[model samples]
Target: MQKDKRYDQLLDRIENDRDELVELCLKLGNTPSYHAKERNVGDLVVEWFKASGIAASLQFITDESVNAVATVPGSGDGTSLILNAHMDTGPEPGPDATEADKKIDTAWTEGELIFGRGVINDKAQLCAFMIAARAIKRAGIRLRGDLTITAVAFETGAPSIDKDQGVNYPGEGFGTKWVVDRGVTADYALVGETSGFGIVRAECGAVWLKVRVKGREVYTPRLERGSSIQENPNAFAKAAHAILALEEWAVQYQKKEKLEFEGGAIVPKAQIMNVRGNDEISQASPFCDIYMDIRLVPGRKPEAVKKDVERVVRGLGFDYEISAFQYSRGHIAQNAGPLIAAIEEAHRYVFETEPPLPPSAEVSMWRDLNVFNEVGIPSICYGPPRQRDPYSGAGNRAMKISDLVAATKVYALTALLVCGVSDR
Candidate 1:
C-alpha cells in the first residue's frame, strides 16, 4: 500500500477541499433527479468537470436525461480506469413526509453523519470521484493511463417492466449501457456504491418477470343472474390464486438457487411486486398482470428463473403467459484482479488496515459493477457504508461525512496506482 508522493499530495488535496465536496453532495441531493429525470444533476456534474479544466461532455441517452462524462487523459502507457456512479437516488419524501424523512432527505452535516438521499445512496460517491479528479488536477500530476468518470441516469428505477408504461422507457443500466454502447470503455471500472469501504467483487443480478392471465370478460350483472362464476372467469381472482402459488414457490426456489462465492454470496429471491387487473372498478376484468422481481445469483440464467415461475403459475390451472420483462446477469470478479488489488491497497493506506469484506448476505445488493464485469473489464465496488434511517428502517439511506472523506481518499489513491503517474 506504499503510494508515491503525488498520491499522498492528492489525498491531502481531498482533505483540504472537504467543504467543497460537502457542498457538491448537498447540491446534488437538493436537485431532484427522480428516475430518468437527471438533467439538473447531470448537467451540474458536467459543469463541474468543465470548470475544473477536465474534458467533459454529455452522453445523451434520452431526450430528457444524459450521462455526465469527464476524463483525465493519459500518455497511453499504463492501464486505464473508469469511475462510475449513478446520478439518481431512491424515492424522496412526499407530501405526507415523516419528521425523520424531512430531516434526512435534505443533505447536511451535523456531527459525523451527512443526512440525505443522494449522498447516502450514490451522489456522495459521485462527488468523491469528482474530488479525486480535482485533487489530481490540483497536483498537476499526469497519468500514463486514462481515468474517466460517469454520472449515469435511470439507475433508481427498472426499465420497461410495465407494457402500459411504454417500451420507450428503457429501464435500469440505461446510462451505463449507453456508455458502453458508445465505446467508452477502459481496462477496469470502479463502482462507487455504498460498499462500506469494502471491496464488493460480486453482486446479484435481477430478472423482472411479467405474467399475464387471460379469460373471458363479462358483466357482473350477467354472472350474478344466471352464469356461474367459472363461466364469467374473473382473471383478477385467478391471478390472486397464482400469487399464493408463487409465494410457496419462492420459499423453495430461494433455497434451491442459493449460491456462495469467495467474493460474496446470494440467496436468489422471487417476490411479487405488483398485480394489475381492471381499469374500471365496476367492470369484470378479463386480463390481469403480475409483476415479479427475481434476484439471480452469478452464473444463474434468466431463462431458468423464468421456467421456475412458469412451472408454479401453470400448476395453478390458470391460462397464463409468463415472460422475463428484464434481466441483468449478476457479475463476479476475482479477488486478485487488478481492480480489487488497487482498491485494497488504497483502502489499507487510508484506514491503516485491510478493509472488511462483507459476507454473501451482506453483499447481495445490486449495482453497476455487474455491467463492467459482465463485459470482461474487471470491476468492483468500494465506498462508504450506508447508514440506516433509525425511524423508517431504510437501508442505504444515510451516510457519515467522515466515511465519505475516507472513500474519497481511497478513490483518489486507487486511481493514481492503477492509472500510474507520469510527468507529462
Candidate 2:
C-alpha cells in the first residue's frame, strides 16, 4: 500500500477510537486536579503509555505530578523524537455565565462538541496526541529514531503566594514548589498544539509579574479629610495612579530594546504581557497585584526585565515589592530542522500549495516547546489551526475526523520523507 494510504488508515483509526478519546478528555477535565491534585490525570497517561508497549512511570519533577521517561526504542540513536502535550486544564472546571448562555450548544451534541470546561483550551491537544500515538502503533510504525513524550501537571496553575502571609492566591493554589528535572532532551519535538499551517519556528518566551499599589484606608463619609477619595475606594484609586505609571514606563522601555524575530522582524520591543492590580491575585485588598508577561526571543535575560520593571514602579513613586520568581520561557529550532523539511515537503505533496509564511506559527501561549528549549534541544510547533472558527467541518465544534485524517497524512508522509520509503 502507498504511504499516503497508510496515513489515511491511521487517521481513520483515530476516528474509530473517537468515543474512547473523548471519554478520556472528559475524565481528565473532571479530575479536579487543575493544579494541586494532579495524580489522577498523570496516572491515566501512564496507563495509556504502558498499553502502547512503552515503559512509563510518574514522578514529581517539581512539587507537581509529572511523568518519568516513556519510551519506545528500537535499534536507533538515543536522540528521542518527542510528541508533546500537557495534561492540565485552565481554571477550575465549572460553567460560568458566558458559557452557560451560548446558543449553538455544540457541547450538547452527543459525540459532538463535548464541551464542559476544557473542551478546547488544551485537553483536545492532549487527547489528539495520545490518539495519534495509538494510531501510530496500530498502523505498525517502527522508527529509526526513539519517541519520548510527557503530559505534565501544573502547566496551567499560577500566581505564587508566600503562604507565610496566610494569603492564598487563586489558580496557583497556594504556591506549590513544582520542579522539572527534564530527564533527557529530544533531538526534535512536535508540540502537538494544533500545528496546522505547518511548523512554528519561533516562540516568544513569557515572564509573569505581580505589581502592587498601596494606599492608606479610612472610614467612609470622611470625604474631605479621610485618607482617600471614592470613599476609601478600597483605597485603590491612588494605586491606579501607580498602575498608569507602570504602563508608561513599559512604553518607554520599548524605545531602548527589541528582539529580532524570524521573517526579518523584531519581536517584543518591550515585555509582551503585563498583569497588575485587579488583573492579578487579591484585587480588593489594599494591595493591587499585576502579572507581567514577557515574551523573550531566545537570548533576552528575564532577570533584567524584573529589575527594569521594578525601576519603573519606583520612578512612578509607588512602593512596590518585586520578585523575578518563576517563568516559562520560549524556544525555537533552526528555521528548518531535519524532520521539518520532510514535514514541509510532505504537506506540499499532499496539499499542492505553498505553506503559509513560517510553516508553523507558535503563539506566545506557553507549551512544552519551552521545556525542550530550556534543555538545549530542537523543537517546533506543528498541527492544524483548529482554534480559528471553534467550529470546523467535523462536528462544527472541535477538530473533525477529517482534520485528523489530513494531519495524519502529513505526519506519515513526513515520516517517509525523513526515514525513506522503507517498510520499517
Candidate 3:
C-alpha cells in the first residue's frame, strides 16, 4: 500500500515524543481509578490534555466518578471520529489480598514493559489516545472533521446490585452512555482496548441473572439430611447441586453459541459469579441465591437464555426462580467501511504488516465499542497486546512500551485518515 506523506509525518512526530508517551502512561497507570473512583486519574488526564493544548473537560458522573472529554475540532465537511478508553481499572484488591494483588495497580517499568493493573486492560490505550492527539496538535495538522478522545468511568463489568447501601455502584458503560446521550457523538468511533494489535468489530453482550433456590428452614438439630443433595432440606446443599449442573451446561453453551464473523469470533460464555445463603452456620437457610453472568453474541435475546438456563436447573427437581437483572445486547458495527479502511492503512504503516485478528478472548469480551455501535455510530476496537506472565501463566498486569508506541502511531494516523485534513 502506498503511504501518504502526512502519515509519515504523523508517525515521525509520535516517535519523537516516545518518552513523553511513556511518562504520561506511567503517571496515569500509577494513579488508582478503581471503578466508581476515577476523579484523581480524571484530573491527571485533563491536566495532560490542557498542557498539550487540546480542548478538554471533565463530565461529572457521580460524586467520585468523572469522564474526561477532549477534542480537536474540524472544519465541518468530513466524517468525525471518537477515540474512547475507560478510566476505571479492574476491581480493587480485597482487605486480605496478597502483596502481589495490592501492587497490581501501581505502575512500574521493567526493561521494555510497563506494569500495572489497568495498564494492559485500558490505561495504556488511554495514554496512547492522548499522545496521538498531542502529536497531531504539535504537527499542526488541522482535520476537516472533529476528533474526540474520551476516557470514561465505570466501563468495567461490575454491576450495581442494591444491598444495604442501595445501588451506589453504577455498572459498565455508565459514563459512556451518559456522554453519548448528552451529545458526545460522532460519525465513527474507535475504542482503545487490548487486542494484541488486532482490529475487532464485534463483542459479546452480557446478562446478569439471579437464580434462587428455596428450601425449608430448619435448625441444625432438627435438620433432616437426605442421601442426595436434591432431597436435602437445606437450600445451600440444593444450591450446590444447581451450581454443578450449571457448570456442566456452560461447557455445552459455549460450544453451541460460538459465533464466527469476518472480523473475529464471539464465544458466548456462562459463569457463576457469586452465591449467597445463610449467614449463620447453625441454621439451615430458607433460600440460596446464585448470581450468574452469561455472555451472548449479537442478536441473542436474554429471554431465550433465561429459558435455556431454566431448562437445565429445573431438571434437578428443585423449586427455583430465575430473573435477569440486566441485559445489554452485543453488536457488530454497521457502516464501518471507511473507519475500517483507515485503521487497516494506519496499522499497516505502523506495523509493516496486515493487522491480525483480535484474540478470541478480547473479541468475546464486552467494551465501550459495543456502546458506540449500539448507538448507531460505526465503531471498532484496535490496540496493542497484553503481556502474559511466563512464571505464573496469568495475565501480567502490564503492556509492552513498544506496543504502546505502535498503537499510538496507528491511532494518530487513523484519526487523520478518517477525519481528513483541512487545506488551510
C-alpha TM-scores of all predictions: 0.90, 0.72, 0.96
Q: List model 1 lDDT by residue over 51-158, tens digit each.
A: 999999998767667789999999999899999999877554589987876766667766777777766767999999999988888888889999999889867665
The candidates, ranked best first by lDDT, are 3, 1, 2
Q: Pick the TM-score winner.
A: 3
lDDT of 3 by residue, 163-217 (tens): 6233235566877888898899999999999888888999989898999999989
How far does residue 299 in candidate 1 sit from its true spot (Å)? 2.2
Tell me which of candidates 1 and 2 scores higher on lDDT: 1
Q: How many backbone collisions does model 2 have? A: 27
Whole-model lDDT per candidate: 0.80, 0.55, 0.87
Off by over 4 Å in 3: 162-167, 390-394
| TM-score (C-alpha, index-matched) for candidate 3 | 0.96
